[model samples]
Each structure stands twice: as structure tokens, then as C-alpha cells.
Target: ALTWWNSHVRIVGNDAADVMTWIELKKKMADTYCPRNEMKKIESEFWNLEVQEESDRVERYIGGLPDSIHGSVTASKPKTMQEATEMTTGLMDKKICTYAERQAANKRKFEDTSRNNQGQQQPPKRQDVAREYAAGSGSRPLCPKCNFNHDGPCTPRCYKCNKIGHLSHDCRSPTNANVAKNLRGNGAGQKVTCYKCGAQGHFK
Candidate 1:
């Protein structure tokens, strides 16, 4: 699926939005940065020009607008993998600028809002934030039998009983596996003990 899609995006188009015409939208693209991830944004900061350069390089790839209707853009002379990698590093610097500008805008809104907990919340507790961005909600729920939340071992539970210890067929109760076929005549356990002579029969 992705191979087909990538082939399409790599095709160049002569449409107004494609080719070097996107240079017109450069300023807009520069301004159209995706804002900080609510959880991923860093509080303290350090400075490094090399890191900035790499960020700009990565941004070039992401900010690239197709020069053609089919969205394919290319350089006159092809580049080797090493050159492409270097270019990507420079684009990373640009990406940082884009995201930084976005974060600045967000800072103005939630600038003074106090954090709910003492420190930043962890990933499991950040589900609501994900939902706000249209990310799907988690499907986990408390186990009906053991009542364990995400803290319990991830044993497969029977959908009917909602128990995590075992599946419905292998359940110890007199149902399913035991009803028509108790081949060994043993219960759920694989081994059966003899009541007399301490000698066990394979199937009694």
C-alpha cells in the first residue's frame, strides 16, 4: 500500500501548487509549523548550532511542495545517498524553526496555566491529551474477574467470564473441553492422581 502511495507523491506535477511555484508559499510553510507536542515540549533548553543545521535539513523534506500535479519534485542532477542525507540534516534545522514558531504561538495561550500534577504526566495518563488531537482512545478496561487494571499480567482472558487467568475453553469448570471429550478423564490439569495403590491409570 505504501509503495503505491509513495510512487504517486514522488511524481512531479505542473499544477500551480507544484514545482518551484511552492517557493511562493515558502513563507506560509515556514509559518505553518506544527506546534509543540503537549507532552514532548522541553522546558529547559540548550544551544547547539550543528543540531540546528540538522533540523533545517529535515524540514526541507517535510516542507517540500511538489512542483507538479502528481507532487513529484526533483533536482536536475541526482544526488547520492550521502548527499541526500546531508541535505536532510540541514532540513532538520528548518524543522526546528518551524516547530519552535508554533510552540511560541501556543505558549501565549497556555502560558500561565498551572500543571495538573506536580510534574508532567506520564504516557498512560496522557490519553485525554491524545484524544484532543483526534488520536484514538485506549481499549483497555478493568478485568471483570480479577478486577485488575493495566497493572496485572497480560494473560489472555475469556471474553465471557472476563477472567485473565485462562481462556473460556480451558476453564476449569465442567464445560467445553470437559463436556464431550475428557480423553484422559482428568480435569483441567494434565495429570490425575490415583485414589488407591498410589498407581495412576492413564485414563480411568
Candidate 2:
């Protein structure tokens, strides 16, 4: 609304009547000066149509008032009142939906508990299951530059070992001179000694 004012409403006219129809008002508010009489006509016509009042009465009322209030006081109605109605069973109000969601979630938990009670489970409990599937895991690390957490640890397999754990830096195979020269660590433009070969390039 303030954006409406700064971008549109607060430029030239002080009287609401001077702004005129919404479009005209918008123009006037946006640094274009509109005349008071023209705005009054549009305002009067708008109120008359909106409130189902006679045009004469609207004009008279406008003539009688000071021009501070730009928009009419006619209640804000939906453009299509009938179409705006959201038809739902009275049973499915906000309270009902909230309760339904909670109950469904709880039910899923209980069903899983019952299944796990009958067999070995990958995740033992809700918290374990949550952590297991969470975005932050071995797959995620806080940060690459530091120990900050991330979605998971890096998945780049060891270039030497072809395994998931350690990087090529700690692998048994000696580092390749070409690979060492090619490696860059941490971030762009960083320089470091390759831990594997002790040759400077960038590091893991």
C-alpha cells in the first residue's frame, strides 16, 4: 500500500478527489499533476456506480466534502462475488485441515512403528529416520571452505582408491604429477601444496 503511495499516491495532489479514478489517481500520485475538478468527476462517478447511488447525490456529496480521502468508502467487494465463494464442506475448515494433517502424520508414524516392531528397520526411530533422510548428512557438509555443515559431504570418490571415504590426498596410490599440478583446493584462484605429492598447485 505504501508502495502504491510512494510509487503512485504521494506525488502532487493532497486531496483524494484530485486523484480522480483509480487509474487517473495512480497517474496523479505518480508525479503527474491532475486537476481537482477532473478528479472530482471521476470520484463522484465511481462512488455513484459502486454504491448504487444516484449520480446527482454522488456529485452533491463530493461537492460537500473536503478532498482528503482519495478512494471511496464503499466496502471492498470481490470483483465477482459469486465466483469468490469457496465451496467446501463445513467440515473442512482451517481447524479441520490442521487436525487432519497432524493426525495423518501421527498415523504414518504409528504404522511405521508397528512395521518396525515386526522386523529389522533401516531407521530405528523417528529422530533416526529424520536424520537419515535429512538434507544434511554424509552427502552434505556445512561448507567446503571450512567445517560448516552442508547438504552432505563431498561425493567425489578418491581418484586413487575409487572409494567414497577419503579423497586422493590420503589414498595409498602416489599422486600423479600432472594431477597434482592440475588440482586446485578450496576455491577459485587458491594456491596450495598437494598433500599427496607435496608439489604446489592447490590442495584437497
Clashes of each: 27, 15
Off by over 4 Å in 2: 1-33, 51-99, 110-119, 122-204
Strongest candidate by TM-score: 2
Q: Where is model 1 more than 4 Å wrong at Cα?
A: 1-78, 112-204
Tens digits of per-residue lDDT, candidate 1, 1-204, equal 355334534664335335445564554444444334522344323322243465455446434633331122234221343455555555556768888999998886565454544366656646665444332323455554433444356577664344567766656643333333545555676554332222334322
Q: Give the per-residue lDDT digits (tens) of candidate 2, residues 123-157.
A: 47876665555545566545553233455555656
lDDT of 2 at 61: 44
Q: Distance (Å) between predicted and true CA of 191, model 2?
A: 78
C-alpha RMSD in Å of predicted model 2 compared with the true structure: 23.9
Candidate 2 residue-wise lDDT at 65: 36
